[model samples]
Target: MLYREAGQFKTSYAKDQAVFPIIQDRWFIALVLVVAYGVVPLVANEYWLQAVLIPFLIFALAAIGLNLLTGYAGQLSLGTGAFMAVGAYATYKITTVFPEINILVVFVMSGFVAAGVGIVFGLPSLRIKGFYLAVATLAAQFFILWLFNKVGWFYNDNPSGTITAPPRTVFGIMVAGPRATAEVRYFISLTFLVIFALLAKNLVRGRIGRSWMAIRDMDVAAEIIGIRPLQTKLLAFAISSFYCGVAGALYVFAYLGSAETEAFDLLQVSFPVLFMIIIGGLGSILGSILGAAFIILMPIFLTNAPALFNLPMPTDLSKHIEEIILGGLIVFLLIVEPKGFARLWQIAKEKLRRWPFPY
Candidate 1:
């Protein structure tokens, strides 16, 4: 009943086309933002801030990026981790060389660097697609990691071959490095996710997003309709990589602090993000957030559930069981709800809208 929009009337195009046209949705989004910005920081413990929240936000951002490319643009990519590595390494280099610059600017610059790399790698999308395109991106995953591993210049010729986030301050508060508090890092990550998610949500409703979707649906038909495949596909890759690059920077500076190339390996970064969109729902921004939260929380729950239930499960067996369960859940969800959680949420909302009497 509360979901009713009976009195809400839009007399203007902007009002009618608003992201949350329904007053109820606008209020709900506002409440969510208030809780996220105002309440979470005040009550969350260090462990929650560091282990769960920060990583969840970062992964959500990455999933959004991948969702834009793979889900929206119909370009299959397996090089997500590689792009993240590009962002991390780019941030390291930028901060090292120009410590005087703002950290926010450095993050944006790192995203551009990753965008350039993404464009270069995304070139093959014009020539190939589907499994072959995925294979090409997979090659990128291996090649980029290999390049980072072998290049002494990337890690500042350090024998460790590891990239570490230099101490950085935002508005006089340390948000990166060993001295940074978990709360500050969480704030930074949360801010980035909020901004990016809003931008992505709006962007998907605009012309460029429509072009990408058209290409995704049918490239030949899109071309017949005046959508340039090259520009559209490359632009998708560039924007997607930019989002991913920022996510990678957050992963390092705001979350991990220090990491090696192995941290962004295909299995660790790539597959998980792909799984996120697949499980979250393709072509849906809300799905990206839900998917990230699901992926991030599931493992933690699996590990902790045994102790909570006082079950005597060995560590090795527990890990195996976790793997089996995750795999089974993915398959089951695919069978039951192919569009993932976002679609289910949409259906529930429709039901609510038609409540009290069956049509």
Candidate 2:
């Protein structure tokens, strides 16, 4: 009853087109923000912060990036891990070379580095698309990883070939490095996610976003209507890679603390993010968050389920079971709701608005 919009009347265009036009939705979002920003930090333990929340936020960002390209722009990319590597290595170099700069600035600059690389790779999108484009991007995945691994300069000629984030402070609060607390790191990642999410939301609602969608629906038709395919497609790639780059920076600095080329390997990084947007819903920001949480938490739940039942399950066996179950769930969701969880949520809301009616 409280969720009804019967009394809500939009008197202006701005109100009608507001992000959350319904009063209940705005309140719900506000409540969620309060809990995430205020309550979670105080109550969450090190295990929750380190093992779950931090990764979820980072992967959510990456998923959103992929969705922008594959979902909204209709440009298939299997090189997400490569772009993330660009960001991670770029951040490491920037912080080491220019120690006086702020860490936040380092992240943004790293994203631009990734954006430049994205534009180079995205040039191919002008000619080919669909499965062929995916193949081209897969090549990028291999090539970028090889470049980073074989190039000693990326790791500063370190024999270990590992890059570790140095301790950094923001407003006198330690947010990264060996001595940083989980709460601080969590807060930093959360802040970045919130800021970028809002930016993404606005971007998708603006003119550029509409151009991407037009190209996505049909390139020939969109071009006939004056939408430049090359410019729109490349813009999607740049923005997507930028988001992934920032995610890579956070994944290493805030979550991993130390990483190598293997940290952003194709299987571990790229495929999972692709799965996130597929299962969560393409072209939907909220779906990215939901998908990340589901992917990150599902394995943990599976590992603990046997323990709860007092069943003796070997680690290897449990892992296999988890993989099977995850695969099955993906198949089920694809078969039943190809648009994914976000679509289901939308349908539920529509039904709620017309409660007690057959329609």
Candidate 3:
């Protein structure tokens, strides 16, 4: 009964095409935002902010970027970490060279740098696709990391080979570096995620997004219908990389504060993000958030569950168990609901709309 929209009527095309056409969805989103910006900050402890909320927001952004390419554009990439690395290093370079510029501007510039790199790598997609395209991006994953690892200039010649986010402020409040508080960092990450997610939502609903979908469904048909494959595919790569880049900047500045190339390795960055899109739902923005949250929180739960239950499982055994469980769950979920958590959520909503008369 509560989920019914019987009285709501769309009188115009604009109303019909609204992002949240359902009043309940808009209200729910508003409530979520209010809690995230208002209540969470006031109540959350340091650990929750630093370890949970901040990482969830950052990873969700990255997952959304991947979803756009893999899910919407039908491009398979394994170089997510590489693109993120580009962003992190670019941000470090820009901030160091032009200290006068705002950090937020640096983030956007870093995204552009990653986009350029993405386009270069994406060029191979013109003639190759599917497994070949994935292999090409995998090559980028290794090559970019090697370049960053060997290049002393990229790290500003730091002997430790680590790039650190130097203290920066937004309107006189510290948001990065060692002195920055968790609340400030969380807020900054949340702000960025919210802004970019909105932009992504709109972008995916526009003309270019339609072109991407056309390409994804069938490139040959898309080309026959006047969609330029080269432009469509490359634009997907560029925008997707741009999102990953900004997420990388946030990962360093808002979360990690300092990181090495190893931090963005396949296991640490790429595969997990791919898993997020798979487990979250390939073509869904909300799925990215849900997948990220599940991936981030599940591990924490696994690690702490033994202690919480007063079980004396060994640390190494517990880790292996966690891996086994995660692997099993992924297989099980794939078999049961291949479209993922987002689809499950949609199904539940549909059922709710039917209520007691669900057929």
Question: lDDT (CA) for every model shown?
Answer: 0.94, 0.92, 0.94
Count of residue pairs whose backbone atoms collide, per candidate: 0, 0, 0
Off by over 4 Å in 2: 356-359
Clashing residue pairs in candidate 2 are none
- How do these models rank on TM-score, best leading? 1, 3, 2
What's the C-alpha lDDT at position 151 in model 2? 94
Better of 1 and 2 by lDDT: 1
In model 2, where is the ten-residue run with the lowest total lDDT? 350-359
Instruction: Give the true-structure RMSD of model 3.
Output: 1.0
TM-score of each: 0.99, 0.98, 0.98
Off by over 4 Å in 3: 357-359
Cα lDDT of model 2 by residue, 50-102, tens digit: 99999999999999899999988999899999999999999999998898889
TM-score of 2: 0.98
